[model samples]
Target: YTYNNRINRISIIQEHVMLRRAIERGVSTERLATALAINIAQVEKRLNLLDGICAETADLLKDRQCSADVFAVLRRMKPTRQIECAELMVSANNVTMAYARALMSASTPDRLVNAKRAPKPKGLSDEQLGLMQKEMSGLQDQYRMAEQTYGEDTLNRLLFVQEAKLLSAQALTVIAQVRFAKRQTSVDFGPSAGMR
Candidate 1:
């Protein structure tokens, strides 16, 4: 059972790494299975397990009212920095979307059918155009920052996965060996065994 548990944990880590890399590279699970020499069902099962693990991990993180060793390990093992970066990117995207919508409404008369602000100029002056351009430039900067963060997050996650692979492999191996030894051992005692 211990051996199985260790193997399960290692497999979970490996599957997570593989799935993340696949998504990052835009590769489908079917293709990942083919690449990894595993069947589609195996990949799917691992993916499902990973999803469960992720959900549990997330719940554990959210419940600040409790404590668990697993959460501590997960915090260290999981790519939390990448997660934060991704969250920041998402917020930045929302800001960019809002800014773009506002700028577009400010620039185009037909699109501002519902806006409550003062009526904008039917044709933008050089000053207004430059202002719009400046807003757009800021949007571009946000976009670039998001992209850079994403790239760095990806690299960091990849490195994290590599470390997990090594640690998990070692753990699984030791657990398996212990399990094997336990299974092979037999404790035979006479009826007076408890006499000691």
Candidate 2:
């Protein structure tokens, strides 16, 4: 006979509560693991699900359908950001592990539990990101100077749409600046035209 793990497995929050009750009843880790037919580390993980969690965020998520890994991501955030993310999840009606991880990825260092250990931009350090910002601004300044030298008629209108990477609000500012610099825009403004 084949067994289905889904039928035997409980929800992540339920397992957390069950493990808490077991611990209160003087159950040892090994004994609990044996009784539950799971690894001791699994039992330990459930027991510590709320270790760094705040009351508001826990209450917000206690009844939500989220995986144990979501809590792991929440543990990396500060309480305020945890609350904010929880509220956002509730508002968006999505409490998936992927969404939680996305929120974690978008969080700034100030909103993290450990700023010193905050994840850097992929393949770039803080200093590199700073330098890149300076370089981008310089390019924008050059574009403005060229427009001034040749007039808007000589230059083609440009539009920018975000697709490649998640960027700061500054990217939108750049797009707005480019749009403002143009006076007349054509119906099909060449290869670099953005959507209306």
Candidate 3:
């Protein structure tokens, strides 16, 4: 039965939990195996699995006694990510704003250092300057939205990890069901009718 497989997985997870508890309690493997109703070999398999896990994660999987510490460590290890596309767009937008500001500031021909007395190329027309300001504001809004979306994606990744753990737990249930089914006797309907 598939239950058998689930049973196996549950047993393994249980063994792992036991081994971790043993480590925390300073209990001997022999005692832990006895307590868990599993042989020493199985206990060792669980220990090996624990040995490979990182300290912070192992702590989380085990007793969860210091959740604050675990969270702090995770924060430190979190990646330093940047939104490249958004950054590029922001840079381009900044350049455009600067250009517009320069045009707006340019002195008229009457005031130009070189114009001495001629008119300037007509300092940025009011309409064009207003349009430039609007475009700059729009880009800034887009940049803000981009950052928000990136943060949301990071949250999604954390959720996915949690979901994976849930699925793994479900797998154990399925395996147990398989194991149980396999132990059942089925009647043969063809060729050997009523041979039970």
Candidate 4:
């Protein structure tokens, strides 16, 4: 739609695309900034919009109307956390910088890019955050295990159904053959067959 392409609905992403194209065409950054009427810093930032971002997260947000600051927030977390945050944003229809920061805040230190340098929440003590992190990690593990089990169960059920269908087809073929055999054996005798 015009809103997406021209009206900056997908602002940073569209700019990134244009910037990449210009860069590939050997356009200087200053020239690009002048052409786009933005500063060189912004032009460079747009060019590196997906620099540290994982492909999956970028794909998830490529079409959505997300704040550029959201990427800056996401870039702080590890790839897995970035993916989780992106999925949350997409599902909840909220891609503001605040939401991204909230998601980052909820993430365990281990999921951060530099766990040692990770920031703590304003209210929660380190001990409390650790406890919450453990609980969240446990829940994530349970979800992954359940998902694997469900996938295996589904595959087994499908294989069973396919086997059952094949058996049914074979049974039908055998029944048909038996009926033909019976008809062959029950052929009528000629009028003088008994006398012969």
Candidate 5:
């Protein structure tokens, strides 16, 4: 006899919680792998997904639709940097592993959680890294400014367009009234040819 089982898709947050609970309940990785019908490595990866993540960063990303790999990349950054990167990703509507890795690459050594284990640059020199850090700082400032002004700018544009439309309608109405009045005056006074 064969038994068919239906498995529901789980969110990243839910998976993390389940893995943590399983560990707390003295469940082994092998048991989790068997239960989930996944490989032992996959079970271990999910179990350690939030191992190095700070509470604040975890809370910030709890409701996000990002994958476990994205959180793994974020674990390389310090708490403050993690929060900043998470906020940036959320604001940009991007929560991909690539974006997280890019943020990690742009992070300075001091901003990383494990500065000693920082990835060595293959082709780029220290000077290039410094320049990149400065550029990233400038970009972050610009992003914040844009975020702050977005709503106000949108409202201003909407008001301007509405006012222009209102003015255009009023102008058209006035022009039509003027044309009607002129036609009436011309009729009352008789044709110019008749006057001549």
Candidate 6:
């Protein structure tokens, strides 16, 4: 068979959606397997990959370059939790199956789709789970705060560079304006005022 270069690489969601559409259009799993050069069981697995996933979660991950196994892990999570985990994975630039599994393990039982059969992490007690959830929440808050401050931090650095490029009086004036702005914003300027 000739390699089909026209078929560009597709994401996990695309593969699942395509397979699902084929099945819905009365395509046989055996035929799909032959066309994709995979086994019938694998074709069926792909077709059913999004069986229990919510539309919102699927939409969130539609463009993500996650693996099929990542979706498999995500399917165990509730819709809201799935979105949160997907966001974290995207922010961290990690969409691996292992990362998905770690997120699943870190999730609280209430956040799982099958709460009655929630998978327990090895060596993790209930207390540990609670602590992990709290720590994850705190880390997520810190990540958001850092992201919000990133542009301001860049602007501050540029202002410092501009001040350094100017003459002493201009530089001092710029520094004073910056300090005044920082004070107005309630940002700590530390003991740098003593340097002047």
Top TM-score hit: 5
Which 10-residue window in model 5 sums to the lowest lDDT? 1-10
- Across 1-196, the per-residue lDDT of candidate 3 in tens digits comes to 2456545333333556666887789898898889879999867766765342345443333322222222222222212111222133234443233332233233222222233332223565767745664675576578678777987889999999999999999999999898877765463356667565
On a 0 to 1 TM-score scale, where does candidate 5 land against the true structure?
A: 0.83
Better of 1 and 4 by TM-score: 4
Q: For model 1, how many clashes?
A: 0
Write one digit per residue (lDDT tens) for candidate 5, span 1-196: 1243565555687788988898899998898899989999998788778888888888878877778889878888988999999889988989899888878888989999888887765798989888988899899999999999999999999999999999999999999999999988877564875777
TM-score per model over all chains:
0.28, 0.56, 0.25, 0.63, 0.83, 0.74
lDDT of 1 by residue, 57-144 (tens): 4432331222222222223223443243223334454323333334443333322333345234468785886578578647656876
- Model 3: what TM-score? 0.25
Clashes in model 1: which pairs? Answer: none
Best by lDDT: 5
Candidate 4, 56: how far from true, in Å?
Answer: 0.6
How accurate locally, in lDDT, is each candidate? 0.52, 0.76, 0.49, 0.83, 0.86, 0.83
lDDT of residue 166 for candidate 3: 99
> Judged by lDDT against the true structure, how good is candidate 4?
0.83
For residues 63-145, what per-residue lDDT tens digits would candidate 6 score against the true structure?
A: 77777888888888988888888778887888889988888877778888887786787898899988997888788889989
What is candidate 5's local distance difference test score? 0.86
Clashes of each: 0, 0, 22, 0, 0, 0
Give residue 102's lDDT in candidate 5 (0 to 100).
Answer: 79
